[model samples]
Target chain A: MNWHEAPDMRNWILLLLLLLEIATFTFLSGVRFDSAGDFTAYFQSYLGDLITQSTPTLLLAFGMTLVLITAGIDLSVGSMVALVGCIMASFPGNTEFWWTAVPLGLLTGLTLGFLNGALVAWLDVPPIITTLGTMIFYRGLCFVVMGDLEKAPFITVPGYEWLGIFSGVIVMLGLLYLIGGPYVYHSRWLRELFMMGGNRIAARYAGIPVQRRTLQVYTLIGFLGFLAALSFTARNSSISAGSLQGFELQVIVAVVLGGTRVQGGSGTLLGAFLGVMLIAVLEEGLRGASIWGDTYLPFEISHLEYIFLGALLLIGVWVSNIAHQRSRA
Target chain B: MIHGRLDYRHRRRIYFLLAGNLLLLGLIRVLLKEGSSFAEVLRRAGPDVAPVILAGLAMTSVIFVGAIDLSVASIIAVAGSAFGVLVHHDQPPWICYFACLAAAWVLSMWNGYLIRTLKIPAIIVTLAGLPFYRGLALIVADLGIPDFGGNISVYDAAYHQPGKFYAGWILLATIIAALIWEAFGRTPRQWLARGNSEEACRLLGMKPERILQSAFCAAGIFLGFAALIAVTRLQAIEPGRMLVGFELHIVGAVVLGGTNIFGGEGSFGGTILGAFFLYFISQALTYAGASAYFQEAITGAVILAVIGLDCAIHRRQKQLDELA
Candidate 1:
């Protein structure tokens, strides 16, 4: 394969970008370490905080990879997260809240995902239109449920904050990416998803249960949304109807930036991990470099994150697409 | 596919939307206060509803060519920001409006150009544009105006002409022209042909990519008017928050109008009816004394129910065709 054609080459480039981002940000932010012990502790705390804070986005990105791999997109994941959190937070902050609200949130998430699946699989509505409708519908429901109130019942719930820390990030992401990812990467089920994405008719003709698999994939995302809600609420400790208005874009950008074919049929979980870290670092770096920006630039440095993100997405997808075509030739 | 017959369901959908609009109008009539004039309500509906209608028309043209522009709200925001910046610079009103129109047209064409050259799907391109353009708007505002606040207030009456005084005329003229062009012009037929199957269009000796680009070009004209009306109607243009979630509403209305979401099988006439139907639904609810908070949820439900049922009704035919 040509250097540009190899998937390994693509990932290496992403790794390069990540390192470049970190080094530049560190320099611009002008932080210095005086001692090895101090450096180690700072590293530990910063990594922990970064991973924990972005847990909601990371969890959503995992499901998004599966969805995109199957040639479907979910515009409603952001709304789904908010709706789940809103529903769960409406309950009184007591031990009973966990038992009642948690179950309800799970049920709601699964049901919402099922709705999207049914629309796509059964009614034959295109996934974009179906989810676009449901996105608005779900966001509307969030408002109806919580009105203007920002509820934080999770803050008062005992032991819930555990999910917001490094330990929680380890368990949740490990289960999805570390364990389940490899399993799916090698499974016949994964092959089926790729087949469906490549061409739906051929997959159906090959005796794949198209509707069932579609439903399962979508509902699985819903369950992931439930987990995301848990992580987000634990960290942020409050929820509103519009809490994550543009969140689906972030997750989609990360997954797409990972070199997942938007046209479907090919992706790797490892690539997705790199994609997430790259974006997360850029975001954090831009934020941290505000002191540098205050004097040098007119606009806020943090605002530049949007421009970088858009540029990154366009460039990332364009390169990955070229790679995909070149490798085939 | 280039010569595929129009779907009966799409034809029926137009009638359904028409009926829905009439029925909602009746409800609004019945619920109106004793002293209020139904004539006034009818007259005011045009300017109030033109933004969505115009935007839906733009979306319809794009979807007709198997593409979607999710960056519409962002495009409008950028246009609005351009208008605001120009206004703040004390440019004439016509110049400001023209700048707004031109900015929208250029960005829309840029979306077309990128999709064509890069061979990326329209959805992905515009999805990126959604944020990129909004940020561009804010940055433009921040740099262009001194001591820029979040929003720029347009206090001049002349600045509001397109959205306030001439919106109805602009909408009517555009719709009439669009419907006529769609019915009689070769370009629109080419768009439908390209939408049906780009490969087929190519084999037929038509430039499918050019056809697609032309569709976007045409959509830019309609979108220019949409941005003009949407921007000029507002007393203040806030680049960050303006038209937030407006793209979804336009998409919903377009889809609801019986246009196929994937493109190649819908009418501009149906889109007009769909937009009116949605507007009247909200009007009826307001007149019926429903809470404002419930209105958005109800609009969403209506979109889901209408589109879901329509898709379901068409499923049998789709399955037969696929299995064959």
Candidate 2:
């Protein structure tokens, strides 16, 4: 029950879930090969598609895991993505110009994130209500800025396609794993996030500077949202107010499925990374099977993905609860 | 010094609540003067505002227990969609209505069970239920039930009467509920207990879980009835759009009516006034030639402003309490 005690059972469950996900993907993909000629092609393309679609979610969930570990939720991430994507797409395409556009978009996102942080940290607003208000406000701004128009040309820029495609996802995941993993595991300032989430008043009394840390956490989430926006825009080659609709929910779902407690205190970014992959694989695999598919249902699978995700989240929570109960007992 | 301080504190609290109500009434008057016929306006506003008032009432109950129901809108959607499908299948209207209500009640009970027994946070439980209910609604919609006719007006005698007179009925019900609650609903005692500390409530042998469960169940029933009124009035259900963001509106109303979002202190009367204030503003904006988009922005602003005001009042009260 102590903070440093490893949640062995939850970790094992996470591994099992990941394995089950891979198996499901394999089975759903039909595992076809005609004399091995098409085997690598089908396999690579399927894996590539899964990685590509999941990149943004993975990045968002990565940051979300940390935020949730601090016992705070960011409902504004999706709106931040839309706002940042719109800003990036509004710029005329030129590889040389992306340096400016991307940074500017990130700054805008960071500023919005800081606003969220300030509200919660300084103004004493609850995270849920503060983020809820910002969610509406930011999305409204997006609509106002974009005029509700869906811009397609910016996404199709030369060299930009890689951002939405598999290569970009892999690169982003790699960089995060390199940077975020160590910062979380090794640093004192960073580790306090879990302690703060575990018990804010105690952490505050312990000189953990709860308010400042909370602000930093939300601001970082906003920055990650900017990165996700870049990836998403590059992939779809389109930007609209509706671009990342319902995305925040997906990120939260992924985080929870990864076994992060909503009440905060403990979680691993690695679990979130794997969680995104699991969801992506499930969707892609279900699609490849063509059992029942529709435009709304990943275009290649049935609407069952939603139900499946919900069930997974519930089961994950239940299992963790049981583990916690038993550990306490 | 103590006597004077107590007198000042009591007067200040009364003044604050009165000022909030007066500001809302002023907004209503401004809305009433805008374009529509006075009589037609009342008729239209009645049905349109009824669900919000009812839902706000329901939300108030949950807020009293310091919990929120994000899934209420989805419940409305599911119930509306289910009713649409059943009625389409030539099922008796009464049967279809009851079934929808029953389903919503059961789902809410499930939420209560999860929060109480499983000890899940109310926000997380309701957040999950929000999507689950939406998915259920969508699935039911896609099951090949015929769409309710566009602009189909329900003229069923029984349904028409409720739609026509429900506003007054809601008002009466709200007054009765508030009186009953104030007199015997354990408000003063629970507030005293929760305000002291949750630990103190347990030490005093209060069954917090039972209280919360009952509150959620009651909210579920209220929401079901609100959904029924909305669908019956439309005479055709569009689950896709029926109560989208309706929960936010209810929350806004509750908060504006002076209910503490953090819980324990609120009034049903204030909530009724809050609902009327919102309905009036929307009606006014339309009459003033504002677009629906502007109306939404205004509503959002109103919600923020009300919450902001509540925060100020709460801070002042805390200061006074400390001073005492």
Candidate 3:
């Protein structure tokens, strides 16, 4: 059975999302026509900030896509980010601290992720319950470590500034694309995650190392969380326990929107990337528009965005089900 | 011979459940402080926690069927907001109460339909509903009524009586409904079946979709009543922040009460006691001067501990059964 026969509707969704975003941007930018230069400048700055702001979520989503494909979730990623960010921002004043801090953050993330893997894979705990418990535990630990205080700028080293902006995001994305893109698309071990998600018992009976793969996937998410935290803190120039609060939800939404089934198996990283971009751009477009732009939609911008997201998520699943049914028929 | 064996097994299960409840209560008592009046602590914790226990039970019913409703808190918010809005208009208290309940039920049914028709997982559907319903509550609150500015106080006799006394009656009614369900209902049976193995249940002539829909509907009614209790207790509703993080507490209570997270096996008695135990623990911990942060951490740990213990017990029971 060629699984690739499934209709690649992710491209269409991405196209539609992007078109809507561009239209919103165009219309909203038109509102300030009297000051064209100011509008253009503000738009550029806004776009820059949006890209930088979205980088961390994008990174997290990239790793999350793999985990979801394996039919597991990494709730501790958000806490991992906060913890790593705290560590990065709490580096000693010495210039040599970057070497220690970066490696230490990554190590911490890996260890935590591995622990999650161990609990679920080795101890036979259910993934949802295990991650749910760790989600709170890790967050509480971060609070304890940081003493509930926000960490100040500690990464003021000469070469560190490059990790915070457009250039940094591009480099990081490129590295991930190089390493992960092929590993998922070409490698056999990696492809087993898809098969495992499709049917765990079948995969296990086929001699797949389900437990080991689960461990590896969670560990990857932890490392990505570390990278994301490093970049996020550098961009923001500070760290706090609340730095990445509720981010796991955003990652899940992106992964699902990008055509990754929440039930696991059958997804692409590119789709996840587009999903993150779509949400970020939608928010940016709404903010550009003068229509209740001051308040974040659900809480502040505009409640319409959430409604739109909910509708899109429902529609995506419905369409996918229809497609599956039709293909079977 | 079969009847005797079944009776023996049933008695054993009851004994086991009772022993678990007693252990939990004893743990709470010890944790609170020895030599203090345990009866007094229970009495004080009872009324203070009556509403949460009611709401948690409603949530647990849905969870037992292997579905979750994250929108319970949102329902509470909207119900409270609607009640406040009606009272602000000088509407009769009875009308406001019924309206709030009706609104919650309709919203909950919408959740049920979304999950049923769309085939979306409960977690995703309800996560989306959480914010969506909260937004509705906010909008309703924003549109202030004629007499009152933006807030509705429950100082009036009509509201206070329901909030204080009748709300407990609603909880008692829920317990009765659950008992009736356990005793003579195909709905609960189907739910358990679906939770265990949907495919197998389907092969066995059970319509999983219909059973799930009915389960959600029942859960919706319970949630509606829970929302009423919340509104009456709060007297005023700020839909924006009402019952934030309340779903966690409900799930924690359900799991602590001995319900399997994977679904299929649990008892209402265990869950009711679980709710009481959780409330008592929180009160006792607070009384012992634990900070809010520590309380949250401890609560999370307790949930993990309970689930872990349940898993261990379940595994051992399975092993014993297999040997037999």
Candidate 4:
């Protein structure tokens, strides 16, 4: 068979690339294994750190995949998450925050998301424009609520710290990816989203209630944003107005790089998982590879993330387009 | 019938902007204090607003052709980096300015080139360019300056002249030229044709790719001027932090000007008005003594309100057309 007709080649390539990246960066960072146990210990800790750091991104990526599959985007994801954190930070650090701040954060997230959905669904504004406007709008609201202050009520909150740790976050990710992923993958809703992304007017003609679905998809993103805020604030123990700046792009890039379509119609939860891992690994590797960068590179090692991100997005899109063409052919 | 082709919505948007700007000026005049200078405020508005209008015009061209360029802010940052690098090396002021213009122009055309050759969506190509160029800017800055601080300071009077003195003139010159060309130019009309329907344009033997390329080329020139002014206006050039959220501001202005986000419609004149209208809103907020933090929020709220209203008003018509 022609290479273009190969089944699921990109995923395999990504897996190989992930391993290659780990090996290269591990070498560059000069990690030595004292024993087999030492190696296992290091990898375990590294894997845990990666999960804790990427919990928010992975959660939001699932929502973003669903949104893109419905032919929409949520550029306001970063701002939405930041706003929730900022709102929650305003409450006292006592147990009351769990009841008051957490619920308020949830309400704010849903309301903000519903606003985006209503604008796109009822008012007929484009998703990009609506979210772009709300991105700035919500960020501005964050500043308004928090001012120039940085708040860390989560640090004092009882039992909230576990959300940032390996075991707690791992369980959450396991439930989301393992259980929810398969259900969504097989559900009728996913098929409807695929149709809507493929052709909105046709889906409406097919009685998919395009408007309601659009509303639901965006509102669901709001709930995800709240969850992301929960994990982020718990892990960091602080919140600021401008936290998670450019985060939406990161998630979008990861999801898109994972084989999700930018123009919508088709995406995979598995691809999103791999894509986020690919980026997360690259970021972690680069952070460790600063020793090499200090001698050989003039710019900060972290800056390379943006360059790699762009390249990876392009490569993924190329893979996707080839697959798109093969299907058409 | 000078605007004979403008639909009712676009026309109302123009009128609304005109009245809005005038009302804002009036409010500013009222809010003027005894010690403060209203005339100075009016004078500052020209140069202050030039970069935005130029960028808006650039956005207008690409958006007119049904494509969006989300990377122009990063392109400008790269231009600023080039300008800073040249200045740091003791290059002539002219060389620095020219490099700034050329850098932005080249990157923008490169975007068009990629989209044309690769057949990727313009949004994706530019969106990729967003961070890609930002990293490029930082690397270039890191490479150029010996002791690369985060920002490069230009202190010379000569270097600052373009942004400080000639911004208004440059703005006027570009606006006049762009509006005239837009009114009488076959090329821009071809862009509109392609934007409306690529397949139709291809069937008619007009190269949609070439037209799309032209839109980017035109956008590049406008963006070049915008970058030059914006970079020079700043005493310290920080490519990393400069124009962080500027892309959305340009999009807001373009959409407010009645350009369809998906393209196939809009005007330079409308974009100018929309840019001015947004500027005036912030100015009005300032004159009303709103907090600095509140201005961004209010500006966002205002954009949402206007766009929301415009879309709502046209929703019925859109639904009717879909049914038709």
Candidate 5:
């Protein structure tokens, strides 16, 4: 009945949904089974690829989780990542990438994030409107920088491709979820964030320094966006002005699916992690089932991804609310 | 009479929009080639900016009741797909137009109902609707038409009449009707009142929920026209890509017109001028030979600058009130 119990119960539901998804997709994709060992190997690689391919989304979802916890949304993360990637791509792909483009990309991410923070915190613009404007502005800047070009400098960077692989993603996930998440779970700072989200006016009156927290949260999203850009470019090996379109929605949906309330006040890092995997699994599963879909369905199998994503988001929120109300009742 | 009829707050915004409109007009006139007449520019304005204007009007009501519909673009896509499918079947113009308008109206009303009944925030509902409607459009297209390609192209000139020729008339008539309604009608004021204080409206025997729903219905009517013009103007209806990010432009225009983003105060005249101001800025950039890439950046900057300035100007007053 308490907050702690409510989330755990929701997590159980999510895990069950995730299991159902995996079962359905595995059957649809028609898993090959020559032997037990071969089947295990196939499953392991499939899972690894899903996680690795979704690393950027996972990293951004971590930040988005915290942002939504503060009752704010960042609509510019996609544009921010694209801008950072586009900026990094302007440099040559060589050993010098470490010294030249990497730091600059971080700074770009920080500066852009700070601008969003300032608008929302100091200028008092609503987070959604401010980010909406910056989203277009940053995207436009990407076009100006790249000029309708796609750059693949990331592929030529020394050892950079490692970051896009399974091991690198696993390391990032370990740091973010296993280590950093627990650190946040007990941190007074995050508690203060929840307080602010619950009631900004009361928190301010209670000496929470609301503006500073707002600025910090947005700036944090920006920093995470930089990391996301690194993972994305390293994996995809290409950057274009139009890259990562609709990516913010994907991250938000994943976090929301993981049981983070959009109204803020409560969230769990583990929940977001599960949420991202849920979507990633669905995506990869759909792609894997393309043959089956082509034979059975009337439309492209991938087209169903959009419908599923939307439906799952609505259903997730709807289910979570029902659970919340039942607990209170 | 005009001075006596308006509040000091709205009077200031009206004057500001008028000055901005004049400035943009002069800038455009200067940028045009030597022989080009101002009349020619004006003539093209209505059709070119009809969609944004109508959508802005649609947003104004929803915003007036302190809600937003981010799914307008997606709704337009669905409507456009329906229109396209009908056209592909060689349906009469009235049937196609009716289908398009009906789709948009029904979606808007559905959104309103969902927001009311589900007790969810409009933003969250519509954020979900954004993808849901887009995917729905694609599904509708796929199921309705056999041998569906990605796009449905309407080659007949007759189908384009509403967008190409009648758009100007539709826009003008709508503006006049909106102005008259805003000035004298009860519904618009009810929206503003509900926006101003939902609790107070309830205390006054007004149902805020019903008021919000009515605002959405009015918005749906405007959105129907917007979808009609928007779809007709396009030679091809590609549901996957149709009207992506169109909601931002509408929001920008509505905000630029001095409509409160939180609702409670706005005018149709201001939205009309605001939409024109934005259109002229892009047109001026084209005439001045600015790079195509700069158009979006300029528009974003302009929206940010206007909204930021307005917010800053009011911040001191808000702070003063808080202190009091």
Candidate 6:
């Protein structure tokens, strides 16, 4: 669980892959730079926008890393965020959002997370099954709350737009990943999570509070879900029952790509960060190069994203496994 | 039933599902309008339940060998895309059906191959395949059709025969075949053995990997029929959007039917009943005049409640075994 435990080989490889993607897509997108400064400016603004747009995913990836470390997954995350956003949207876009809607949304997320934890930890329902069930149930609740309505009241909320901006998000990520991440990385708390994930029964028999740890990890994800919902709603300035569909998989993929084992017992927040960026870059690159794809490819360029993302996940996991085996040898 | 192969839990699940189905039917009958016959319920049951039951059966076989496929819905989309492309080309209906079946079979076999070759878990392989196959479907449709939009429309009645007309017959035949296979086949027993313990299976001279692969092959065949039925029933083949959330429903049905999620024990009869029970639960919601939005919530709650209760009931036994 050391920050330097896995070394930096995978990160360097991912960084190179990200650079290659940007280079290819930039050429494909026909970005014409008048000067060196112009190119730098263009890239700066592009990166800024990409980070701003993908803040929710990045935040969730932090939480997902911890969950994976515990050998549990919260597939209900997307639905949880959507439901929270929908709940927030039900209120007016005034200062009341601060005192009423936002806190309520956070509580809803905590309650939902606690319920998921109870099912998995207390009732002994498998994490996957519990989350799958909750994924549907939470989504169903979203539909009931919003009922085919798309709410956009966040635009009127004072200072809410800050959450969507580069500077604001940078501060948040700096705190979460830099300050909070390192704290958790070095803590006995996280080591205990690793222990539980590596072997739950062994940890339990050793007097680790297994049930409490499971509950805490899930509840922490819930708090992260609240932050994610805030970031998502502020940026999109809208809410709907179906918003953020397929988002859980995106977060899971990014974390997994970061070399987080699905079997758990180990993960790094830094890896999750890099994984999120790699995917965010690909997403933006595909969008920018859509015209190129239209000309050179038979399918819609958007469809290629799915293909690339899927291929990237498989390749990432396969290569990681190979590296893992080689290191073992 | 079916000799001693069917266990106590399997029988209990079958009974539970059957009772639920009948209870829903009775409620619907009692609440029916004067003119509407219970016959309407029977008539609509086959096509409605066919795909889910088939998918459940497919999943049951895989889960029997301690693996799962989260890629079934995506695979269905691929099969549907193939069917749509063939129909667009004015291929014979039978040819289109055969091609659809082949697409499912090949992809499922490919799933087996990937899991075997990579030594990665089936869940991870299929999780990747989920989006990969959907993208493959979209790419296939985009490449095959001229002036392709988001969806390919197939309005020909001839092409809809399997999904619309013959779904019942197909369901009956497949159910019968699967039940018989579960009862007496060496393959099913082998799957159970592998699921129960891979090392023990190897010690007994059986190859666990090969047995697992054969289960996938059997699942592929069942999924082929499921895909055929699912695709033909749709008037428009929207590969990207078609059959979204189908894998969950199939998983739900299989688990409800008393199949262990961790594998090693189950019954095809239970799966058939599980699918019917789910279908009837939703149908009852419609009849009870519940809001459409509430239906999904109710379905999710029902699934959670059923599974949660079952797990809760067995918690003490599991704890005791751990202590032992």
Runs in model 4 deviating more than 4 A are A1-8
Per-residue C-alpha lDDT of model 5 across residues B206-308, encoded as one tens digit per residue: 9999998998898999999999999999888899998787887788788778788778877778788888888888888988999888888888788778777
- The RMSD of every model to the true structure, in order and in angstroms, is 2.0, 4.9, 4.6, 1.5, 2.0, 2.0
lDDT minimum window of 10 residues, candidate 2 chain B: B1-10
Better structure of 4 and 5 per DockQ: 4
Each candidate's DockQ:
0.66, 0.25, 0.30, 0.73, 0.63, 0.72
**In candidate 3, what are the lDDT values of residues A282-321, reduced to their tens digit?**
7667555645444322233444565566666667667766
Per-residue lDDT for A182-291 in model 1, tens only? 89888999889999999999999999999999998899889999999999998899999879997888888888888887778877777888888888998889888999
TM-score of each: 0.96, 0.84, 0.85, 0.97, 0.96, 0.97
lDDT of each residue in B114-171, candidate 4, tens digit only: 8888888888888788889998898899889878879999888789988999999999
lDDT by residue (tens digit), candidate 2, A1-329? 44224665556657787778777667655575676768778767867887778888988898899889988888778888998887777777776546877789999889988988987776666676677667766776676567758887664466777777777778887788777677667889667999988988778778998889988888988888888887888777788875676778888888887878988997877778767777777776666667424433432234456557766777667767777776667
Provide the TM-score of chain A alone for each candidate, in the order shown. 0.97, 0.90, 0.88, 0.96, 0.97, 0.96
List the lowest-lDDT window of 10 residues for candidate 5 chain A: A1-10
Comparing 3 and 5 on TM-score, the stronger one: 5
- In terms of TM-score, which candidate is stronger, 3 or 4? 4
In the range B51-94, model 2's lDDT, one tens digit per residue, is 78877877887787777787888888787777766666667778
lDDT of 3 by residue, B72-130 (tens): 88878878878887887788978998988888888877887888887778877887777
Q: Please, what are the lDDT tens digits per residue for candidate 6 over residues A1-329?
A: 42233647678778888889888988988899999999999999998998899888998999899889889988889999999999989999998889999999999989988999999999999888888888888999999999999999999999999987888889888889889998998999999999998998999998999999999989888888888899889889999999988888899999998989999887788889889998888888888998889898878888888888888888889988887777766
Angstrom error of the Cα, residue A67, model 5: value is 1.6
Going through the candidates in the order shown, the clash numbers are: 0, 2, 8, 0, 0, 0
Model 1 spans with C-alpha error above 4 angstroms: A3-5, B1-5
**What is the DockQ (computed on Cα atoms) for candidate 5?**
0.63
Native contacts matched by each model: 0.55, 0.06, 0.15, 0.64, 0.50, 0.61
